[model samples]
Target: MFNDRPFPVDAFPKIIRNAIYEVEQHTQAPQGLIAASVLGVISLACQNRIDVCRLNNLRSPVSLFLLTLAESGERKSTVDKLLMKPLYQLEENLFEKYTHDLTIWKNDEAIFNIEKKALMLKLKSDIQRNKDYFATNEKLKDLLQSPPKAPVRFKLIFNDATPAAIKDHLCGYWRSVGIMSDEAGAIFNGYTLNELPFINKMWDGATFSVERKSEPEKLIRNARLTLALMVQPDVFKGYLQRKGEAAKGIGFFARCLICQPDSTQGSRKISSPVVSSEHLPVFHQRLMEIVNDNITLDNKNDRLCLRFSLEAENRWIEFYNKVESDMGFFGSLSNCKDYASKVAENMARVASLLHYFNGNDGDIPLSAIEDAVKITTWYVNEYIHLFSKPNEFTLAITEGDELYWWIKNHCNRHVVPYITKNTILQYGPNKFRNRSKANELLNMLQSQNKILIGKRGKTTLIAIANLKPAI
Candidate 1:
């Protein structure tokens, strides 16, 4: 089944595909088991090293928001730990190194504060006595010059965090970090989910103003936030039931690469877990290299530039035009046109991610751009399935229409002028559990002039009108 898909696991980079294959050997999950995991690694790998090269005179940040829908027992957390282990190790190493520096800095700050307080006192005394205060003020200025700065607990990834906390962390990390959560509910249902405006702006690499009472307004520039969220289908469904339209309306889900692959619960079998080999170590090592690769942030705190080849540029132009065509009148993606319009940008970002993962130099390869397009196509289909409404009919309404069609076909197949209530309860396409539903459906059909419901000898009957399905 995965082999037949447009973007199969095999289409991923060799290192990523190898890692996914190794993990699947232990978990026995779906073929796309590591789809979100790969994105998680990319989120951290591309955090500071690269951005999507300009394509068709347009460029977008390589940061991505990804969601993989599965069930509770899909080993999502195990996969997360495996992919993020290198990041955790880096965090530990940084903590140990920063601990000593922070202590020394704190001692220097204490001495500096003591000297500053003494100078302030002396200056006040001199001013009150009408004495020469300029000399004392000069001493104070010298004492306060070049205040000590404590080391920050730099982090590569965060799991559960509020938007306000995320803002502060971004500032600490120079406005570049990745958010990875095995459970999406932690973020979707958190207190800061209401910070949608800030979240949206950051995702688009727009400046966001962080207001504070004590400090001046901070304008965060070139904020790149990469996210990889995994959620059970039912939890995501619940989120949709409550905040689906609102989330989509604000372009939250529109910026995501969502995949609801078939579950691999009942089919999973016990197996020996594979030990870490050079194959997996190489990928992890590369990711750590990116983490340690000193990124030269510009005045805007933006990462290094990533350029594309001429052929890749042309391919993006063709892809952009195709997407633009569908964002107009009577187009299939008119409802979610905002998402459709960003297809080219998303492709560029994906290509850059692949380019970095492959350890490539110079312009991005055409093969990477093509693969990105395929992945984006799958994302478009998933988005339509989730958000797009056709002819004012929601998925529920369309499904109800389908049920009505099945009933009509069932009656015609038996050549029965009327479909009995007992027959519908027992053998109808839906196998309705109660007669009330059948009665209400019959009433609706009667109003549409498709059927007539009548009672005959204490048994309810549905009389077919026009002898054709309403759909």
Candidate 2:
């Protein structure tokens, strides 16, 4: 029961949809990759500035955790680079400002240290001589109070960072950040995944204390973080093979919106026209506007809370109940109950992102929630397709379906009326490339009347039953 539906690109706002379309035309990348990249950028920009209010009055950050699984030459990096241009430019500008500010602060800090040393000497001498030391003590107190303040270092994105480094940055510098990478082998294979509990807490937006033996304990409060990683299919499967049980036990994968799309490798043409420079700049401008607004606020942690309208709330509750029911013992989503449980909240988070990114100021409308549901439902099905274990009958159906598609595609491409069984056994899907397996699936399809098996001059030929000729 692998429901491999295409991603719902039309559910996105116009700005996002246009960008995805233009990028797909230019790069010929899978729409799933482009959509994931666009959503990652939206999460980075909106996570710090907006919060979604659930029906229970509880507020949650709109940050998202995305995992994209593709093959090696799928152009994942190219898609990411195109969408992340604004963030790169912002980081460069912020780094320059920080460097300038650091220089001035260093000189002021030197002068303050010298003055403090001299004042301490004078105060000690006056105390020993029993002279009036009250005025000197007061002067020293004033000097300590007026010591130079260090400027805050503004950084928005990190590629490969340890859990400790991430905690330090959020606690000591900016309260909002994103950990994004085109190749995330370091993150999945390193110490970051080892600390699942820490990452889970950050995703929950919970207040937690990080205690160090050599320094004071740092408290992380009202901090926001977005994690988006793109890795090859084999690497991700290896991670699951090693730590699948632990990850499920802690509900780690339950927090992620994972996508693994069919590759578009051979279909991309070198002569494809270059993308019009129009759509991406609009996307970049909108992203910069939101980021700049977040930067200029007096308190970075203060977020604008968005609530659902009455109609939207009713729709949300209905969706919640539907998901809950589907997690029953015999329901479609019963295998992945953890993911099903969290899908509603993820839907709300997505709706909030859509609402805010479109510059809507009022409560989240029904249309946004409806659109979010369509997108999130696709993710729900994708999760099941990737992670769920199918019974024997299900596996047979899946294999038969794959073989059917292969035969149909081969016929259409080569303009052949029938395919030899030997050709299928040689070039079909790997699962059915053997003699015994090929016969088993071919017989099954013939019984279903979806394909015909016949012989031409002592050679077995396979043809798609009633497949219309190409126009």
Candidate 3:
């Protein structure tokens, strides 16, 4: 909804004209009533923007963006209307959508789809429009060039989250498939999958200063294949060694999908890795379902995505010829990155791999992922839980739910910005509620030895203590 900053187009004029008429409507009422009526008029006029864009499914936050761009009005009534009306409508819409379906297991494709298109269009257009800025400003355009073999940050919570019991009831709900254990609370660990095609798309978008472009996709493929083979070496590997074509083809697809060297960036805008299985039919079916869901709802964020992408395949080939090319290229892919965000990202991806290899996926099942998010929610009620302050003195790592998990706990009351995958600002400490607390947290971080860096719209702090050469 923003491009670091946004440029208001037509919405500016509408606010100006409406303010004049609002003052006229409230002349006769008493001072209190007049004040309230005038406020109401301005608010209503500004909100009629749903009519202006004709987008019924507009997100609550986007309206605020448009309103911010509204011209300042002189009359108190007009000003108040412009200020508060959009917010009111936004609250109304959000309340209706959340309450009816906030239950554990329900297909949220409807909401997801509406939100996806709105965001994707906004994001894509912004990138396309600013092509010139990126071209001229060498520094800005450089942001899109992904490093080799980037890791996917996977956040999975594994308490008592199970899907089989809730499958019939939930849409986006992920439940544990087999392990029916009360001991488990819920799991929410962030994973970073590699990006394949997106790398190509971004490279294509960039000035093409990259070393190798055409064959980049090939190296990208080998990287994904290496990872998939690594994903389940004992069981799935022996099978893939024999299957030949399907193995190669699916390997290629997986290579392209996961946004990792071993990962394939699948057709869906949603981020998920291709896991090998003896049950191809079931896997295929799930793949189609996920793709369909992604098509229907994938928004600007791709929702949450891995910055990692397959090095263009062709580039991989040259790299192989020049390099060891053994272990199927794991060394080439695991190279530690210099970028600040990518540094932590590599670790998160490795963490997901640890959880995934532990039979957590099939054991826990997919539906529980969202359920696992509760751990993050509970994390914010106070602090100093198991995950809280783990690396505070060391890496300065603070525990909490990711932004989505945080916002969702509030039923996405308003859009909460994310800083990387795991951290976010909780809504509670706003000016009206625990303001001092929020300030204290922010000020404390700002005053610390480390600096905070934001990525994908969220603030992330770097702990000097966490620094280590690539593990």
Candidate 4:
């Protein structure tokens, strides 16, 4: 599910055509009638907007054109292009439609405007004809309730009894809990908005709520002794409601985190689901700063360990080899033993901070020490081998001179960086071998380098780089 392929645009036309065919076959209408009504629906697409009512007629012909493409299974790939042509055609004639000698409802208008009205009329006529042939099923009658054309109800309640002290304890309180719901409103449908303290009130206040409402009257009136057992029970709870200008933007709703189902009933989920990009800018920047500070803290003097620094000028240099990083541009430490030790110690503090936050093992390991040695050795070889054509990797992780010459030969001919890993990535060594992953990587390597030249313990005697780029 994480990596599902996107639906191919080319298949859309065919997919829509099939849906139309399936619906038509089920309805058993004359082919002409079913096809015509489908076209009408497509043509009406551009007219559905409440704000763009002026386009009601103007968009009909364009909508019809889209449906035409939808019907021609092969035309799906160009669906957007097909739809844009008619709209652009209309745009080009916008001036003609507006410049009128005298105002009459239908007379003095652009060609696109006139065509739009004509298409809509055609759509209406076909729809009415198809409507008469439909079966008189009860379900159909029930579904025929024309959507109530009621004007929007903008009136809302915003009374809060929460003490100013408790409500304002935290800066993000209103958003943290559904507090605004406990407001007054003209009673509607026999239910009223609830109001109660959210903070400093536990379940002991059984009626305790930030805001809540009783269930529907029908559910309330017929309660019996076993009613609670008979039903799941309509819950009374505090929920968010918008007030003033806030409601206009948010449409009168409270998206409170505490009131969410997953976080209800004394059991609160830690960390909400991964947040969206729209709200992540400030969060991520703060997170990065914390990480940077933590790393700086970890690299303190006390933590610069050096068990793997047998060849290092100092102990702290070892730990510097780990943590390739998400983002860092810190300069490399000097070879001077004292400076390397200081840098390593400082880096260890950073590692410690990471461990503390993640609640996991945060120790500097022996494998990393070994990997650090390998990295140092590779750095030395890089200077001398910089001009070697097809630079066969010579930095052997666990080897003597024979393995070194074997690597040198491959790069001496082909123009590739021949290299091997001691510290596989920024994290240092994987003491635990992952052969399958290694082989998967091997398969991606030059196929001609198939022969395993030799072996060192469990590790393979293979060229790290040759004709291919270095690992």
What's the lDDT for residue 64 in model 3?
9
> Tens digit of lDDT per residue, candidate 3, span 1-471?
101111111111223223323332322111222222222222222211111110123211000000011001212333233323443454355456555545421344444445555555556666888743433344333423422222211111111332221222111221101111111111111111122332222211111122234433211110001111112111222332344235233322211111101111111132334432233233223323332342234212222211211222222223233333321335322221111112221222222222222223322222222222221112111112211232421112231222112222222222322222122233221221244544454445446523233333343432221232121
Model 1 agreement with the true structure over 1-471: per-residue lDDT tens digits: 112243466667898778777776756665554776777678766856666757444556788888787667778888877777878888788778789889999999999999899989999999999999999999889777778887766666777778888888766546677878887777767654667778778778887888889988877777788878888755676677788778778888778887765445434546554544556677787777777773433424446667878888888888888888888888878888878866777778888888887888888878888888877787787667656753322223443353455455555445667666777676543324467876676677678776767777898777667764322
Candidate 1: the clashing residue pairs are: none
Rank ordering of all candidates by TM-score, starting from the highest: 2, 1, 3, 4
Give each prediction's root-mean-square deviation over alpha carbons. Answer: 8.6, 4.9, 29.5, 32.2
| Ordered list by lDDT, greatest first | 2, 1, 4, 3
Estimate every model's Cα lDDT from 0 to 1: 0.71, 0.84, 0.24, 0.26
Worst 10 residues of 4 by lDDT: 222-231
Relative to the true structure, candidate 1 has a C-alpha RMSD (angstroms) of 8.6
TM-score of every model versus the real structure? 0.77, 0.85, 0.17, 0.14
Model 1 scores worst on lDDT over the 10 consecutive residues at 390-399
Better of 1 and 2 by lDDT: 2
Highest TM-score against the true fold, candidate: 2
Strongest candidate by lDDT: 2
**What digit string (tens of lDDT, one per residue) describes model 2 on residues 1-471?**
133566899999998899999888877788888888889999999988899997867789899999988767778989998999878988999999999999999999999999999999999999999999999899999999889999888889987778888888888757888989889988888876678887777778988788899999999988888989999766786787788779988998999998776556534667745557798889888999999988887554568999999999999999999999999999998989999988999999999999999888899999999999999998887788777753321222367866776676566655687788988876554556689988998999999887888876888888898863222
Candidate achieving higher lDDT, 2 or 4 = 2
Model 4 regions lying over 4 Å from their true place: 1-3, 8-82, 101-471
